[model samples]
Target: MEIISNEALSRCIRDAVRAELQEHFKTGGSTGNVSRERLLSKQELAAELGVSLVTLTEWMKKGLPFFRLHKRVYFRMSEVLETMQQKI
Candidate 1:
């Protein structure tokens, strides 16, 4: 087994992330041939929707669609809009 240095490991991780992001962007933030749907963080979504963080949290509690990655929450704009329309 070959031991990898910290710098080498870090570089590999960075390169991998960069490649994945490039692919994600190339596909318009999607994995397959689907409609473009940008992922927004909790803060971004709240700002875009002109709502406060507490309101967004309430929406989440009410079953607004969202996903978690690395302990971070993310919402897809398309899904959020659809959910809101349904709620209306």
Candidate 2:
């Protein structure tokens, strides 16, 4: 069995993470420079899905995919539909 020193392991891990971050930044993050996915507001999503705000809130609690940015809630229609399909 071959064992590496703690410092070597740590350095290797750090280098790998740094390289990944550099690549991510180079490509303008996970979604890339221009995101084609349009983010919908809570009300917009609720209306689009033909559900009430209350039901949307319940779905959010039940693991419906959502995200909060700038103190506001948002959802991607594709993700919401995918999550709902999974729940069924």
Candidate 3:
């Protein structure tokens, strides 16, 4: 003789239904890239390197490690990484 408990049966059924629903949604849902790679600006560059915008402005004033393209300012990511790694 064997007996099945109501609680155990309900738990097993609930888990099975959840697994099936997951499989069903997996095919219809997105599986693509979601985020965009952002370019670093002066503010972001300063934050990443633990420096302030004022410090960046001073560097520019001193003519140290800046990029000027077509009359606009830019900073190289590699240079920022190096500056972060280097001791001040």
Off-target runs (Cα >4 Å) in candidate 3 are 1-39, 81-88
Give the per-residue lDDT of model 1 (tens digit) for 56-88: 999999999998999999999989999999999
Backbone clashes, each candidate: 0, 0, 0
Give a tens-digit lDDT track for model 3, residues 3-65: 878899999999999998898698654456532334467777778778898998887685545
Task: Estimate every model's Cα lDDT from 0 to 1.
Answer: 0.93, 0.91, 0.70
The weakest ten consecutive residues by lDDT in model 2 span 27-36
Model 2: per-residue Cα lDDT at residue 82: 91
Q: lDDT of candidate 2? A: 0.91
Which pairs of residues clash in candidate 1, taking residues 3 or more apart in a chain or in different chains? none
RMSD of 3: 15.2
Candidate 1 colliding pairs, count: 0
Which is better, 2 or 3, measured by TM-score? 2
Give the worst 10-residue stretch by lDDT in candidate 1: 28-37
